[model samples]
Target: MSAFRARPPAIPTTLVDDAVTRIIRWDFEPGADTGVHTHGLGYVVVPMTDCHFLIEEGDSAREAFVAQGAAYRREAGATHNVVNAGSEPMSFIEIEYKQAL
Candidate 1:
């Protein structure tokens, strides 16, 4: 197991929720975290502010940097917790794409 500890869950604001997608704004104070979760649908992340992330999976942790306005996409089925490791607050928008049900 890793020594990584997650702080309080980051604040989430849902901006849009429709059949096609779910858009959410995640705001994190320095050291705030997104508790462990698994992604059920493909998604894209658009950084509103430059993000310094400390990502913790089952037994490992890593750091990532995403510049403001840089959007990235990912497939589903990933599980992890995210922490804001920078000194300042940061936020990002997540748009999850729904699959045919």
Candidate 2:
């Protein structure tokens, strides 16, 4: 198996008119994972490479094998832990929207 690799946030934070937008690109190798985190604002994920994702939700968890070019949306304030389970590196683009609370 290849060593796990992670990419840092591309755009930590940005001001867009009345709202703040954040963009990040991540690369995960097999058996790689991102520790638990919370999403304050809604987010959209666009996969650049195929990946098998394992998501932990509370006491339960779900797994999904997404193909390249797949797109997903997440609800605001959602929290979860993610893991990558695939032979090749998994890359994705994450876009977050932040508004005045």
For all predicted structures, in order, the TM-scores are: 0.91, 0.74
Model 2: per-residue lDDT, tens digit, 1-101? 45544632222223232456677777776767776679888888888888788887788899998888889888888788777766677777787777535
Clashing pairs in 1: none
Model 1 C-alpha lDDT per residue in residues 1-101, reported as the tens digit of each score: 68566476699999999998899999999999988999999899999999999999989999999999999999999999989999999999999988555
Give model 2's TM-score versus the native structure: 0.74
lDDT of 1 at 79: 100
Note the clash tally of each candidate. 0, 0
Model 1: how far is 88 from its true place, Å?
0.4
